[model samples]
Target chain A: MTDTIAIGTADRKDAKTGTVAANRALAGPRVNGKAVVMTLYLVFLMLPIYWLVNMSLKTNTEITSGLTLWPRQITFDNYIRIFTDQSWYSGYINSLTYVVINTVLSISFALPAAYAFSRYRFLGDKHLFFWLLTNRMAPPAVFALPFFNLYSAIGLFDTPWAVALAHCLFNIPLAVWILEGFMSGVPREIDETAAIDGYSFPRFFVKIFMPLIASGIGVAAFFCFMFSWVELLLARTLTTVNAKPIAATMTRTISASGMDWGMLAAAGVLTIVPGALVIWFVRNYIAKGFALGRV
Target chain B: MTKTLNNKAWFLVLPVFAIVAFSAVLPLMTVVNYSVQDTFGNNQFFWNGIGWFQELLDPSKELGGRFFEALWRTLLFSAIILAIEIPLGILVALSMPREGWTVALCLVLMALPLLIPWNVVGTIWQVFARGDIGLLGWVVNHLGIDYNYTGDALDAWATIIVMDVWHWTSLVALLCYAGLKSIPDAYYQAARIDGASRWAVFRTIQLPKMRRVLLIAVLLRFMDSFMIYTEPFVLTGGGPGNATTFLSIDLVKLALGQFDLGKAAALSLVYNLIILAICWVFYTVMTNVDADRERVEA
Candidate 1:
């Protein structure tokens, strides 16, 4: 099912130059309209983020006293406090730890499965594929209490591994789905040629096949990272303090002093930084990855 | 390309199967177990045998009424967001610059919201839509509109909807953009020679090509919005008398907040089944579409 979609994207890349030229001519008259649309959309997209950033730079008094487009009396105290505070800084480390663990676990497990799905049709392959997808659709809420109980029972609760494994419920399926698409795009002839060259399956898979789908792996890992990082419910429910994610920490910003608007804004801004960095690295694959490689 | 039939392939699939099952199946079994049994304090339990389900399905009952209201509200929210985001996303994708540094710029900026933690998305909106400190709220109020999401249910709903749109429209746009990029120049050139109007070109060429991605975008947006919790939870904490309490939020409140294990489990099962049924429909449609395209190509 995914192979057809993969073929479409592989073909599209080859035909991209011609399409770009055609689009330029076709877009000539509508440039102004397109610009206006893009500007408005981008502005809408950025405004809230800009507000968060704006608030982060202001002192708590300045933030609550009035609305300002830009910080009136800029203060780095919020950022400094977060950096200095152990609880705040540890959240980032914990989030990154589990995200990395989840990404690695998901991609590694998914690679073999994706290769299997792409290369051969076995008994229940179609059923297996569909079943995997249903996991992706399972609401985290439905799993939250059960997960908390299950994880705690197994002594895996409040650890990075718990969240990493919990995330596999969705991320593994996603990785497999995406990697299968990319693998299917590579012809079976490569496998035949490698076999004829006296290469063993594992060796060829590691030495040749891995390089071929490097970007696919990257894309899959990127998604795993994104989902695991952004997800809070299971992560929060599963962990108490040690493995608490930065996102979960941000949710607990209300203090004895009341709403710490400046610190909260600063924390919010910090959370976005890691995601932005990850997105920048995967910007080229962002669109294709969003499509799950179906494009 | 035909795949060789090989049962050895199961070995390759074993790791994923083990990990996923450990995570998915075990918790699922617990949910199922809880749904069927009545629970008391100290982990003592009794067999309830569909009693909870019965109560859940009947609207006259308190649990049932809350369940149905939240369900309908969730469905409505999903519908509204999909209606707004899909067309808007397509337009943005269409309006996207063909080739330049600007394309990357737009793609990056557009995707920024998607990467933000769901809670922070709520926080950003919470701050951004506040009457006192939020730019959006202050502007709207100054424009002579009484806008306060914290107080008014309608305002809460609008804020949640708009926050959703802001957070997710980019995913749809990016998916559509990728789909649009896949259309070969030949299609557009052919349309030009045929003197196709822009709308006609979109309808005949772009829209047809985009069908697969659009299906995906719709499916994703529907599922995510239907299961929305953290954003609304942070923004209004289900807000001003349960106005924004979607199913996930309600379930969390019931399960974790109230510790109503039997009821929450039943609710969870029903909620999950609903998502599964919808997802199954989409999967069937998607596979059929793929099959039809393959047949056409052949």
Candidate 2:
């Protein structure tokens, strides 16, 4: 597990090869096997999304008349409908507003705790960390009733803040865990160095360490936003009709009138678009976030 | 210095901690309170002791109701999910290339489904499984399978299972792929010198190293699958007559749809205990296995 071949093999890829070898040469295949593998994965990954996107562009009649691999004459109607329709736009705003608020709250709370756990051994560090993770593991359905009662009694039910707060339970733990892992990689010496130079801890965290792991914090917040944005159970339970997300709106696809296939497909496509954009940018941060050091 | 928390660090994390604690503790306390109490419509509650627990656990009591049935279904669901997803994810990861933009691209694509919301996944499947109009359903039907998730139990189960596999197996593959990437060429070289077969190298070397992340993968997938609600709920509404109903769906039905708060609270507490117990056991076993691996290495 030690950092084997730390100096040579890694550098070889960057400097050597006057002839400019194939990209797959690094992994032992001449045809760039990684690209092939990645292409195959992209196909697997994009197929359903592609189907949803195609479905979204079509009219309802075209949608339910048995699936076509491609859309028959495209229409902007579904997308246009989502925007022009008051109910759809409100749900979209509801989901977006709360997701933003909750992500901010999660990172703000998690950063200090993660820094504390990473740096200082407090009175109940292990227990507190473990306790935080328990929330991460707790099923939302298990708490749905209590949340309804509690939020309703407090007059918070049906508010965006209710879902925002409920999501904070899981997202905060995740944010803390990811941030802690990132912070731990920074040596205590760095903190000592900053403070020895007369920098305050807050100043030090904000100015010194912040930039060092900006990617990590950004990564954690992206996840926070992602989870809260897509979350349905607690969000759905907490909000009745007024502040529901697009998820709840999509549920109305099923009615006595039968399924609204085109609209549902459009909604599904819209949801995936935001996530796709974030993941496209942060894909590298994700893999590095998954591991460090040698095997 | 290590002993001093300085109180100031708490300020840095206060935003997240306050939000999490507010959401977590009160609802939990409410559940605990109701698990031992009876409540009328007026919000007046009376101590019911462990009466709910006894009824929930008693086999002779059909009062076990759909709770027991949902639990059994969840167990089966979790089992099927693990069996299908783990191998499939491993294969997908193994088939992936080891380096360059290709590796990066694959990672991004694999992560796409994981990033999407769970309910949206259900919606996608819901539309996709329409025999009359959905792409998946139409294709399968074109191939001569009935495949209606809304009407048939088996089709409902199959569609949901396939949707889940499509959704989550990517996560396991990514984690495993990360694990594989971390392995230095030296160990693989040692196996090569020893002339070990690929399966032997995988089992004796790869699987052993992967044990840690594999534990994490299993625990995460199990918890998620057991707690699953939105996807199946969206797809089937726990229907074709309760075939796809799990604990979460039933809890939602009782608490929200039926407005039975007291029973919902009690049921929620039981549900939490099951997750807590399973998580504890899994964590313990994982830690012990890690310890065992350390000893063997020594």
Candidate 3:
């Protein structure tokens, strides 16, 4: 996939304006058609999220009273309850702690490996890369029991580090793959140039190469954080108390009594905020990241 | 760019190897150990050998029957998801604004669903599709159709599929959009010079250009859908009589719910094998296509 994108980019090595003018020409005749299609699609995308947000702002009685497109009587009790409660708020903190750790660990581990894979031909490199991907493909259900027993035995069962470490099985491979794609795009001459100038390997990597692929690092970090933040099963399995993610806390809302619809909606909204903020900050990075290219 | 022969790159890769091994290898070894053994609690065990594997493979047996049923359902779900999502995503991508602040606005909105945790996705759908209060359920029932997702198997299946599409189609669209953006406009200009029809331009230019990212989208969606658990488990609880129970949900039920470690471990191995086999097929097909493209270009 990266290869194909690279081919496309290589074809565009000519001046940028030539392509931009051609694109404008191509898109000109279909403006009306494009607008309608985009409008309809965005509405579909926004509707369910709107419904969830609507539910969160209303009282439980209003929610059960009838179906309405918008909240008739707004209330802040649900959001207030989540904010004031220890268990509810702490779930978010615990989740953030592990997700941050996992993203850092995964990206840091992947950097040098990606550099190696991109720049050098090591023995078993292909096999090792394929092996890493297989871990990503492995279902967490398969590892639930073993992970439980293993973490417990190691006395790291309920800590944030446990979930962070477990997530590396999948996230590290992904990080490595993305970073490798970006690194391969950098001309090998740059590394040779740095070395010829008497720069040490680590020094050269940190100072010269890192900034060159900073966008790639941003993309890789975004993905690592996204996957770790959203994953529920492994995170839930690895932690019971100290590191219980907000997703697990949402499940507790379904007690023997009944579901707490309003509270769950509120908590769900809060969980989405951090990701939305991250996406906003890295919105452009995400498009290039989705390219899976070294843009 | 010829890479130097640098076996010493192993040192650069060692940290990744250590961390991944500690997480992946140790737990996998545990799974392998349990698959071959049996126990009746209290740290006692018996060597079961191939007993569980034999039982799991025999369709006449209970565990075997459930496993195969769940496996078929999972494959069907992935097929349906891919069939609907890929073309729909491309259509949406084609319509997306190519410039201005609207592009940023569209990108963030399209990405909104992807960032929400999977369980919350299920919860939103479960409530959204409920006949009692869900807008989807209320609207459907008001339209005079017998639609009860909780009580009806078909509704349960439809709701789950729709929920999945709603949650994930954005991923495909975003990848396709990125691919589209990468295509040099010179291709389109050349097509226009040749008096190519819109369809002709799409078939010869856009589709081929999007192939690589499309492959990534397909593979990601397939693997994720095939192993789908948390969403369905939360929404349907694998019910309406196991209508929505995919392989992961079944494996979790066996491993955690019933505490049948031996059978569950065997099932897990079989499950992993199936995913690996499918992924290998995808990888080979993609490599062949890439090679073919290169050959033509040469």
Candidate 4:
């Protein structure tokens, strides 16, 4: 338990102010064992991702008949198909549009709820907080069938907005939960300080408290976008071929004609890039936000 | 705007409620309505009361598993995941470089596996596990492991568990690493003055500090493992038999495969109830742990 807490809290302050000597001192042979272990773990982690990228750059014949560490001849046909074709790029746009919308909407709604729960005592506040999390606990399958039926009946089915709406079921809970972490990190004194200055509660929240948790919100948004960008079950049900996400689009490669392994791999490689880019830009936030969200 | 009571918080909560009502609550109400009633073609319906629920509860029904079998399996799965991940994640976090460019590289690369869609994960493993062409299958065969996940139940279950571990362990590791990084140097200094052993220091100092975060990790992991569907769905299709079939898979088979909305809805409600109950326990335990930590600190 203490280990878990240490890891979670140590995350935010770990911008490494240590001297190179101290850092290198820990990297001696004993530590190298751990690093080697970590390296093996990394290799275990990257092999499949590399395979996806490898296959993506190859032709169907190459993918089916032979196996190689790297593609003999790199090709952009798969990527070209994704950009030029309707089904391919449509998934990207639909996913990105909703992902952005969901991220923004989730924060907008969850910020206040998280703040209320974090800073104040009110009627049914605890229950409401728990209620928010109930959405997160339920299985996606439990909701998928009903969501499909309900969305179809209400004429909201088969739209990107519908996917965005369905996504909120999970994303809102996550946003609220993570934002609550950030809000909790800010001492209640900050709110009272702003209050003492005659700043309105609303004004204080937007001006004072928001900045304190800006990093937290960024962390939460990164997670929301990451999860939404990668989700497939809800993405699959909410859209057909027209609005299907790239992940779902790859499923078509399994048709009876034969497996389009090369094209599918290419798509898979493309799919991973957005996530990698986002993580690259926000690695610190991710390292911090992950602790709040999970640990 | 005043301290007395700013009711404007309702405005923020209202959208969440509305969105949930239309999306989650309304659909749930529809499920509740369906659960108690039967439906015919053209959406004709009849009141079936608790008949479906009772039948589900009955042991004779093949679908009606013995009470603890499914429940125990679920619990066992959650336990296995928590036990493996919490320890392994901690170890990984502890091993991570305290700070540097390498940390960023490691974090980004570590997160890559998690960013892939669950189905894509399943697909990747599916192709990668093929005996004829898949590297994993070919290597295992060469080593004479007789590894056939598609045909054997235990193998399938083990494979699924391993795959899940691969997909999710990073979450626990990353979280733990963050928590580990947060300890003030003062604590370590005090421990050093006391001539504390590494194990003692870790147990007495670091572990206690991480309780709140660990609680969160456990709950999130429990809920996630309990609700998992897509990866296993795509990976094994809940086969070679029913070995890897979890409640989520069963629910889908009932609802979508058979289109038995009444029964499936009842099952789903029960499903939600079980999840809610587990999460409730998890949250209570977490909050309790937090309270205990506060008392100790105070």
* Best-performing candidate as measured by DockQ: 1
Write model 2 residue lDDT over A1-295, tens digit each, in one string: 2223432343354345432232123224523554465567567667778888998889988876655788779898989988899998798888888898899988888888888877776555666677787888999888777788888989989998888888888989988888886887677788889989999977998999999879789888878988898788888878988888877887787672877777878888888878888888878776555432112
Which residue pairs come into collision in candidate 1? none
lDDT of 3 by residue, A24-57 (tens): 4344456778899889888987888888999999
Q: Predicted candidate 3: what Cα RMSD to the true structure?
A: 5.5
* Candidate 2 regions with alpha-carbon error over 4 angstroms: A1-44, A256-258, A290-295, B1-18, B189-196, B285-298
Task: Summarize candidate 1's per-residue lDDT along A50-118 as a digit string, tens digits.
Answer: 889998999988888877789888899999989999999999999999999999999999999999999
**Residue pairs that clash (backbone atoms under 3 angstroms), model 3:** none
lDDT of 1 at A23: 44
Against the reference, the lDDT scores of all candidates come to 0.90, 0.78, 0.88, 0.77
Better of 3 and 4 by lDDT: 3
**How would you order the candidates by TM-score, starting with the best?**
1, 3, 4, 2
- How good is chain A of candidate 2, measured by TM-score? 0.85
Model 3 CA deviation exceeding 4 Å by range: A1-29, B288-298
- DockQ (Cα-based) per candidate? 0.47, 0.39, 0.45, 0.38
Prediction RMSDs, each to the true structure: 5.8, 5.7, 5.5, 5.9
Which candidate, 3 or 4, has the higher TM-score?
3
Q: Candidate 3: TM-score?
A: 0.94
Candidate 4 per-residue lDDT, tens place, B1-298, comes to 1123445566667777777667788878888998999988687999999988987777687556633355566678788888888888777777787667889989998888888777888887877776765677778878989888899877777777777778888988887777777789779766644445456677988787676667677778888998788888888998877777778888888788989888888888888998888878887887777676568757
